[model samples]
Target: MSNEVKSIGIIGLGSMGMGAAKSCINAGLDVYGIDLNEAALATLSDAGAKAVSTNALDFSQQLDAVLVLVVNAKQVNTVLFKTGLAASLKPKTVVMVSATISADDAKQIEQQLNSYDLIMLDAPVSGGAAKAATGDMTIMASGSAEAFSKLKPVLDATAAKVYNIGEQIGLGATVKIIHQLLAGVHIAVGAEAMALAARANIPLDLMYDVVTNAAGNSWMFENRMKHVVDGDYSPKSMVDIFVKDLNLVADTAKDLQFPLQLSSTALNMFISASNAGHGQEDDSAVIKVFDGITLPGVEK
Candidate 1:
């Protein structure tokens, strides 16, 4: 358990996964990358990552840990169970789930993987794709001590801040759900503020500057609002992603009888933006829900 994770595999090579793969390479680990996108794999190959032809078919042979960076619990379930990705790995291989999902699902997955003699880390990542690529992302992880010991190198390579929450599986997912709630709310609020500024004839640029330096500022306002300002709504993170994540928050709260007013409101905002055909756009595009307000990217 004290041994280093010399060889590793990461499934789902999107922005976050791609960054992490590069970091693993930088850490000098033998990294195997898997994705449906050949172009992504090609890029990783250029960066010294071995591309897995059949997901874990090639990956299962030699990974010390497998980092899962897909979209949600359903995808996580498929990768670990439906796809034969799980059975391909050797005993005691740590399965790091980095997607934001319900804690229940995380626990269930951990239990299932344990039956196969595999280790599970309910590890969800933060700081977005930019941080992920630099090996400076924050990881909220909880699992067995053996899992963490084996995953030490991978964790060191992928994160600047790591909160080892507890030995229990799914505690990490609980914290991540709370993180998403704040993120989703802040984005929604920024959109509302910018839309209000447009309605008031205030210069969007000036408003951005004022609020950013003002007490009203938040990290999401600074980060996501720029996307709105530039009109570059290309999906760094899609509106529908928050729609899904915040909805998970809503569902989980309902089970506990916990009340979350702002989360509910923000979830609807994203749902509305997605329903109006902007779901594929960046989450910042939630600002587009305001009627008749000119957005930065639009021609007047």
Candidate 2:
């Protein structure tokens, strides 16, 4: 087997997947893209992918590596198995599962892939769409040595940082889930603080400036709270995305019999936002859950 991944197929050409596909193409790899969205496929085709299709099985056997960047484990399973992409692939092909799925789901997928004599990398990514577009995303990955070796080129093209969590199938997912706990909580708490400032009649822009420069600043606070200040609830990352992610955190904790007080609170905040019809809005819109505050750009 070659040490480099020369040709690759990407399943799910959403923002993140499209960015990775474009990065791979820019890196001079033979890239094939699969997505249900015609616009997404068209965009990748224009970006010089070797092929673009709605079905993963279209060119699954032709690829050296496959990156699954779908939304969840269910969608990942649907793309790989329901569409027969896994069975259609040539043996020894590296399948990098990059969804933020539960560790158990990652382990199950790994076992199934091993049954097909394919390599599986439990890889989950962060840094969102902007970073992905620049090929500067962070990847948390775990798999066998052979899998790592085969996937190195693709990783180099797609990520600024790739942490090898372990050789265990589920280790990467575990780490990503923990990371999501921090991300979700930070966004939720940041929204709460901003809402408090608004209720106190503090100018949101000034408050934002103070918080971002102060000791209490966090990456999530600085990033997500800016959306709150601008009142731009456009979905960079939707409230429902965090709802699903924090729910994953809750489910994982339940299985481990662990307590997650702050995460649990954050989960409720997201759920409340989702319940109030902000599910599709930017996650920073969680601040909308607090009433009696006049948000910027929002009419009373």
Which is the leading candidate under lDDT?
2
Stretch of 10 with least lDDT, candidate 1: 50-59
Q: Any idea what lDDT model 2 has?
A: 0.92
Q: Judge candidate 1 at residue 182 and give its lDDT.
A: 96
Candidate 2 residues lying further than 4 Å off, grouped into runs, are none
Cα displacement (Å) at residue 267, model 2: 0.2
lDDT tens per residue, model 1, 77-113? 9988998877777888888999899988998999889
Q: lDDT values of the candidates?
A: 0.90, 0.92
Best by TM-score: 2
How far out, in Å, is residue 112 in model 2? 1.1
Q: Candidate 2: RMSD over Cα atoms?
A: 1.2
Tens digits of per-residue lDDT, candidate 2, 164-255, equal 99999989998999999999999998988888898898998999999888999999999999988888888888999999999999989997
Question: What TM-score does each of the candidates earn?
Answer: 0.95, 0.97
